[model samples]
Target: MIPWVQLDSAKTPDGGQELRLKQRGAEFSIMLGTNELMNSRLSGSEEALAKLSCERIVGRSQPKILIGGLGMGFTLRAALAELGADAGITVAELVPAVVAWARGPMAALFDGCLDDPRVSVREADVGHIIRSDKAAWDAVLFDVDNGPEGIVYKGNDALYSAAGLGAARAALKPGGVLAVWSQGPDSGFARRLKQAGFVVDEVKTRANGKRGARHVIWIATLA
Candidate 1:
């Protein structure tokens, strides 16, 4: 039995909470208080976030997208695997330490995906990126918090609000996708996506491959 070791910690942008990076043998986890934000071993739903989104814009040439969180790089690696060489992905990770964890202790888990030519990592708020652009991305994926309710960073809740959803809608190209990962279901979130003028599909996925905790991913298509 291996014990978990705390490698490093970082504060949320609002400074109300702290994120801890822990490692147990070969496995890694990012924790917010007692809640585990992400685990290297449980990436099924996160991978699905990118896979489902990239799957939607199959034929679009030189597709470009924005990913809200860089978690354990599951979404980024999944997107890189699904997208062609021409595709582009910008990942906005709010906490610099998380990015450092990706390139540092969890580098093996990331597997050099950060160095991929099509990928770019930014230490900024994804919402700002969403607001600054208009019809710029073919897909916009979010895995920032536990759900639309927010856990790691409370300010991220705005990214799921009516106005925030509208900004996301405006950031996408016509028929583009907005894929969001959540720990559980949120009926109000689905409604907000619909109210934002998106054709939505609520998908239930597992934390692991075919087992583990059930997670949700909202595949909202801007049409």
Candidate 2:
């Protein structure tokens, strides 16, 4: 077996905690110590989130999509596979290093998604983007944090809060969808979605293939 090599590293804004990127043969992974934050090739959470989020409103021509994170580009790729050419997608990635990792050592995992004409990558906070716009997107898919409850960053709390859901609602077109990915079920988040004037649907999917880590995808529709 080949050895894992450190490809790159960066310090986050808030805590100055280090984010490390590593490559083992053809596979790439992000880590914060022994914990594997993300693996591009495996892409369990990303694939599930994309599929559940895009399942319902896929065929709308010129549909606009807002993806909250750019982990491994799996979500973007899966979304592209499901959406049409006329559709456009904007991916808001908070950490520039993650974007660099995608374009650098882990580039191949993305399979040319960065250059896709319909796709744009933004280096900024997704919460800010969601709060800024009004009725701008046909679909907003959020895979940031580990659900309504976050792990890496505390600021992520707002993305799952009532005000954040409200912002997400304001950013969507009437009948537009806001899909959020979670590591586990959050009945409280579901309730918040309902209270925020959205018709919510909770869908659970496996992290790998049709079976693996149990993941939740919350599909919320603007009412």
Top candidate on lDDT is 1
Q: State the local distance difference test value for candidate 1.
A: 0.93
Residue-wise C-alpha lDDT for candidate 1, range 38-64, written one tens digit per residue: 898999999988899988999899999
Q: List the lowest-lDDT window of 10 residues for candidate 2.
A: 10-19
Give the runs in model 1 whose Cα sits over 4 Å from its true position: none
lDDT string for model 2 (45-137, tens) is 677677777776766768899998887888899898888789899999988999988898777888899899999999989889888888899
Please give the range of 10 consecutive residues that has the lowest summed lDDT in model 1. 145-154
TM-scores, one per candidate: 0.99, 0.94
Estimate every model's Cα lDDT from 0 to 1.
0.93, 0.83
Q: What is the C-alpha RMSD of each candidate to the true structure, in Å?
A: 0.7, 1.5
